[model samples]
Target: MSKTIFFVIAICWNISLIQAQFGFEFSDSIPVEIGNDQLKFPWSGGINHAQFSTIDYDFDGLNDLFIFDRSGNQIMLFKTIEENGDYTYKYIHNAASLFPEDLRYRVQLIDYNGDDKVDLFTYGIGGIKVYKNTGNLIDGLQWEVVKEVLKSEMPNGSFSNLFVSSVDIPALYDVDGDGDLDILTFNIGGQRIEYHKNTSVENYASTDSLIFKLENECWGKFIESDVSNSIDLNSNFGPCANNGLNIPEVTPRHSGSTVLAINLNNDNYLDLILGDVSHRNITALFNDTLHANPNAVMDSLDINFPSNTTPVDIPIFPANFYLDVNHDSIKDLIVTTNASGSSENKESVWYYKNNGTNEVPNFVFSEKGFLQNQMIENGKGALPVLVDLNNDGLKDLLIGTYFQYLDPADKISKIQCYLNTGTSSEPKFKFITDDWLSLSNSGYALRMHPTFGDLNNNAKQEMILGRADGLLSLYKKTGPGIQDYSLEEITLKDYMGEVIDVGQYASPQLFDITNNGRLDLVIGKKTAGLVYYENIGTKNQYSFKWVTDDLGAIDMGNIYQTDNYSTPHFVRHEDSLHLFVGNQIGNIHYFSNLDQDIIDDNPFVAASKNFANINTGGFSSPFVSQLTDDGRYHLFVGTDLGGLWAFVADKDSEPALKLTKQDTAEKQILVFPNPSKNGIINIKTPALKKLQLKVLNSLGQVIITKELNQPLNKIDLSTYRNGVYTLLFISDSGDFTSKKVIIK
Candidate 1:
């Protein structure tokens, strides 16, 4: 079948067409390219953008994009285009534009009104912003100011700070049972959260009414709930103070901690797992009480962070949380943080059990280092996923280490997988294997986010990892244990024109891109945002191919979730996959069977000096999410410099952000010395372009623009700064266009 027809059939019939024929020949050519209309924003100094937020705002069957501004005060929304690869930021609404300029890391965009259009609920400067989807983006998407529930008015013009307001993260649920959606915002300040439910009569839009303000202690559900009328869940959420969980001595610090509720013990009801960021305690709330007004007692367990005071050093930053690490009926936890000895340069993993005594929540430690048997200089990026790596019924863990550019002694990024013996009576997590899984095995350099799925339909799952060097590595299970495996590294040289960040931040998603018999591997690379490779099981090989009309923004985390068995559906949940990646990146790209052909076209790309001349070698991968959303199955993405993002699967489209033309300008911009030294004078036409360009400081502005009526000119500055300046060129064009220029 033709590629076009196959994709259409795959979307219509979904996974059935691919799985129909067991041994059909896969495609030979791999289609790959950058994303569509990407718009890059401007910045003076550096920006540490993390993940982007996503949701199917309009319920138009497409997921919209919402990104947090680096300093975290604003949220930039973009409308996503599934078909034809359209990723244009139609709006940039700040959820915290009214608050102080503090970073608002966690944010969520959901349809609280069930009116088809998704609303914006995020932790901004001390409050939340409820941007209503007016069902129209013509007038730039109006936002009805939701009152900051965390703030109380004082006698004077000032405000009385009730709870130390910090955005822990936000989730959506039908908590009030009014059929209208509710917002769950966790505040890290005082371990308090304000559940603002939409109390509107009309389902289209409604104002937020402070429904449940469960406070006094930091505890919450991993997934949002719909338990209206009572605080039953709160009562069993471990300990709750009448005031709040405020300590005495320790300075108030926002320890990057998290709280989630899942069915850890396999109980139909969700249990709570709270990470004590400030202390070394991680409490679990077992849902033992089935009574409607559950009198179940909340128990505390300690996930000992790596520290000198304890037998096992307490975990530095209790990050990298996952579900079911052991694969037993009970839930598990994964903590990623700095190594015990070295704080600035190190990485480690600690797993915990769901059931344990009050003092111990069943903790285990597995030291992660270069499998080559090299003494650990240090590792950074900490991520873990539970999978049956060796085809064992029990689940194992795969970890990716971030290389923190340690001196000449530092090794390259290492991807390692561990095999679970499934032995709980003295469970052992042995280092199964290691490889530069992100790099191309064909000798080319590539990096990929690692994922697991049955790519060859052998009833056993395989590992799919993309590379920065523009290659895709497929690992097949050779036997029943972690030690048994063969690797087939598919070099996508033919598909990618330039060596871009393929699978830079996004994980490899396994799906049936082609209507062939077996499951193909789909990835959003650096240069070419989205591409597909057909798996030819007969030859145990893969043929590269491109998804039709799929050119999106810089692709980050990509994930696939299936529901139907006979005719499985696929969803593409993410920011744009092609074009230039925007400053505000999505967490994960969710694509359902219905959106196989819908590709993000125009991706935003703003040049920033922050990224200029800087070796973003390992600093780039997309923050990925392995958790489910609203129990509907979802993936999340956190940007390096942006904010958190998510992708939910179903009939709904991926959430797209809307951005307006803040400003645009382009003139004869120039720089001299050809990779120059000293400084460079940038002269442009049309009155020097009213803007400033500094060399990572406020002391300098656009000193010169060599645009003397010529489209092409040179900027010469023999005596000036000697740093990198993400040149801010402004003109009749939009003022947000960013470019990077360096001085030697």
Candidate 2:
């Protein structure tokens, strides 16, 4: 696809890249060039969070881009093309495989020393790492991974960490007047803009590493504690809001996701602009102080001292990539991430025109999606179940929506039907209706799971819904059409004839365990294990007896079940039966039945947790439909965001490495500076706590023993000779961890 999608989104925005060079007139200042010769800073997307990397990969000196595609977790690279001093970019398809397959992270090109050779810095949640370019930019990067930790000094002279969690996507600047880059960050639905000062430049460090200290917790007065309180009653946002906090509760109207420092008024001093992340607006906080007049002393009191408008809303959207797609010399919005848009908005590039100025950004929200994609965005909490509802030999789709992000008139639970117009092996869905029973909510959540079973020996299948109220409802097919179902209230009784509640998000499936020609039912509850219901009546009349609430010993770990509940489905192909479960932590696990009879207490062995990289981003509802009787099926997984993902198999064979485990034993903790130069090694264990440690040198001698109660620990191996040693961590009531340490 062409990277410059001009036909879909031609929004011309003048958010002033004039702050291209956010220079400071401080006594000891360092200038950082934000935009290149065209004053273009390629950025923008996400719901509200986006991270990108900028580099001159081809030695063209005109920087290329690496952006977050959001939908797919692949490395996206856009190389810049310079012609007639005007720049364009070409999408490099092969550049994706060079980087790791991980979530979106801020990647930057930095040169620690005076040498122009490139070094890379990646800002992520786990921690930041530095990579030196291997000078091989053509075929493969294979940049040797180096474990480098950026140290941080807390406010009270204590040590902790510089987590990207501290600031989602921080802005790099020389805020401390120390002639080095500092970090400035402002978050969405948050209170303050933080300034992390780089202290390495002041110390004249011999090493190339950069150390940081918290200079100002609240760098800008724009977001003070009393800004939303009664104290600032005359303020733009204060007059409109009274939550008594720094941030306003108003959504896209007053919400923001990103913030950066740039000069907007042609006033030498770099000002702050809250980028559009959640909403389409660029809230400008102009700096009152002119350059070197007061030097490079970054004072929070100067941000919007005279009070700029709360929001001059424009589409400086976060997680969005910004290129002059039209070569208009003006930056426009790029909406690749499905972060912001109306419920009717398709997966296309959405844009708006800024009719108003920088103070009251009057954006014309007049455009639909720019590109026409085949994705059906059915709100949030996508609990998809596959069934041949139309009786066309092809499996149709039934989805339950929670209505998150996409607001509708109603917040009630409803089932959506999608007809598969294509063949059984590869299905193409056409959305028929949402209420196949109602219409949409923009940002609300509910728990609902749908399954199919024939209740009364009827040739046509009926819909069994496990609702949020922990009760079951039957929808009987009254006609032959797909929407020919009528609601029927159900009263489920236990084996003892007593009514039983199965808890929330009940996932029910029908199967014959004893092969007695009767359909027995299995239900997934809020907690672990499956619920079994046995049929006792004849084939014409149905009456179920709840035999066991815990069918098997399958415990899904807690991932905040207060709202998110686990789901289950069954797939039987001949003698072997597979149980696929969707849990609260965005993973789908499968278990194979040891024997056919589940009610007889046969334990199910776990199959694989990392199959097909099937992560549903929490609140997963798993379903699989047999394409053929000879062990071929199609996988359909749903997520909390109300999106359905389909995995299919045409041939009898499955993809290799689909059933692999990613979380190995070595991933439990981190041992950095392993090939120790000075015998100083750091142990960073974010997963374990209260660990008892042991270090054995070569020849199996216990050289050191210690106990650690914290996540970060430092050890000095300088006294020992340079060789390989074993470090083991043991906990009486937890998992045992071990790693190899090399001192060379």
Candidate 3:
């Protein structure tokens, strides 16, 4: 056979082997519901238009829900009456008085005053209205509206143009690390985002207000102090601010738009994302925060427009979502445009594949594999879950669609499963709409955001659907053949036999949290904080029994704030498992494992510790994976404001392997600066002649090879991407030694 034909045959044989090893046999009957009514919520108004916010306002151990009735111009507070049971929804009578009758305002319940009670912050036409939670009343919680703190005191209060318009987007975070939550707002009349320092001396005192002064002159100045170096917005303009650091300048074009702050470069400092409506593009101001300086001003690199080419050039609006579409471990941008009017099928959903490094990503739009005709019009959202759904070894595309502006009663939404029919190198998919595979029937009412994993450890992937009506369901593959497909609904229940109401915009995540060999479930609710379900089911059978009574539902203290949408991503650092959950507010909370005992019901409560809160504003989801060959993992956060942010774990900086004394002595090879930033390193060796040097990535894939001609040789890594790389030296004596290097 020819080389091409032999390659095709080998690929086919590999696919067959993968399918046989990973294929799963789905059980008959609907999947059992594991939890109880703690997650289920009654349909209030039309489920299609309801916007929910999850927070434990009362600090009552149970998570409370806030549902926004847009058409009714009302806010309904659903307090958790029973720990693992029902929630009573009460109309906030005082909320109607404090907020405008119109539904244009955004409400966030946060403990801004450190009073321990969650206070209400509403942004509307005039300014931000603060409602102090006095205490629990006979009817419900009593909230008293205070003076407009943001309008009268902040730096932007002097801007006369902003009085008529409201702050477009407001976020409450401790940006300066002073323990007090400061106010960060993107004004309606300008591109600049104003920062208000929380100088309140007394807790819960309305008189302890924010003041704006020239001491923190501009938002950029404060960002400079928080990052490693000064941001040169106007590099051409002589000596802009904070000593004359030459950096890329950001010229904001569209005023009164949206600005999302996230840590795009993984430096742990907040980066700015500005939406350019006029140019129909988004600008990414990368945060160049150095690890050495925790509070220095961040220098920035501007990714102004998407590559100015094919896939990236597609007109992306302010409202865009992201996922690691190709599963290259890098988060890719998923942009959806309005349906084309012409007959020829134009690509509506464009996958901007991330081609660059983890820190600096270059998104290249995919031109193949995906079918344009299979595109859904006005997609509410699409999650690119790269899993072997058809037991084909090749990752297939599972696209979930929530038809915007469509009534849930219409029953038209669906979860489209496309089977990969092509090879790994060049993926080709055929949209599966057959009865056994298509979720159109259940998906209409579901309006789900699907997450795929091996819940049963059968090797095959199981689809976990988070529904709009606050329900968690699982769909597993039935048989081994490509045509043998079936859908089963896994029910979730508590020990009391009550169904769990995982609140709306439910984010269900399955991982081995306790390292017990069994996968645990961590469900995120838009209106009910987070619910942890420990998987106690046996591997012999397909059934899973999740226990929640031990840990109860450990609250992450309203990480999502006012925004109900958030997802949790887990990573293992050393022996401890870390959970990084991202909220719609763009902040990521890092929880580290303190204990590993899985038998204790509430082990996670004592074991899991909240370490850091990294700000990456308004993200759709946070992804944790090995972005580079260096054994360490990087957290890639996907934002709603058209940007991808990355953060390297602290543990990832160290070498994955320890060097042996004998190997070091005999070879006597020295590589300077194991963790290199400039992408250049010197390799010094005794009698380096007749030695072969090879550089390999994390996957053991050799990237560069060179023969040593001198005792001292310099290796330039400017062409290589950032991550962990291994350096191998093979001597003429038939001996080999290797060392690891990190390119930051």
Tally clashing residue pairs in candidate 3: 45
* Candidate 1 Cα misplacement greater than 4 A, ranges: 1-53, 57-103, 134-164, 170-176, 179-256, 261-270, 278-283, 290-744
lDDT of 1 by residue, 121-174 (tens): 555465454455443422223344444544433223354333333424343455
Rank list by TM-score: 2, 3, 1
Question: Model 2: which ten-residue window has the lowest total lDDT?
Answer: 17-26
Better of 1 and 3 by lDDT: 3
What local lDDT does model 1 show for residue 225?
Answer: 22
Q: Which ten residues in a row have the lowest lDDT in candidate 3?
A: 1-10
Candidate 3 per-residue lDDT over residues 1-744, each given as its tens digit: 011110111111121122111111111111111122121211111111122344554446655555442222335445556524544443221233222233433456667666666676665446666666655422134455554545434233442212223324354556666566566554333333455556553343452354322123235433321121223452223223533232224443333333444455555576665443322345566544542222234455554445445523333233123334443456555443211111011233455677875566566766621222222211333333345666756665554443332221232445555565666444444555422255556543634666767766677766677777777776765677543445565555644555666657666777777676776777776653566676676543333444542233344445426544557766665665555566655445544453443444443332212122233223345655543344544444443322223344343123321111123333466787656667887888776356789987544457789988788888988665555577767666444555667666
Clashes found in each candidate (C-alpha, N, C closer than 3 A): 149, 28, 45
Top TM-score: which candidate number? 2
Compute the lDDT for candidate 2.
Answer: 0.52
Q: Which candidate is the best by lDDT?
A: 2
Local accuracy of candidate 2 as per-residue lDDT tens digits, 1-744: 111111121111111110100100101010112122111211111121224446666555656665543332334456778788777765453354355434344554555433455566665544456665544332224343443656567666886555444224455566644456666654333455555667766687532446777655445444433223111211335312322223234232233344455544444566554443334434445454633411222333322221332322223343333333333444433433324222322233445343444433333443543322213345455777778887888777777765433332434556677776666445555667766654223111255666777768878887776766677767788887887877765645554766657876677777765567777778877777778888786677667887777776677766545333667776554455666778766667666544444645766656555344455545667777664344445566675445555544433133211122122322446777756677888887655556778887533457889887678898888876555666766554333445667766
Residue 525 lDDT in candidate 3 = 65
lDDT of every model, 2 decimals: 0.36, 0.52, 0.46
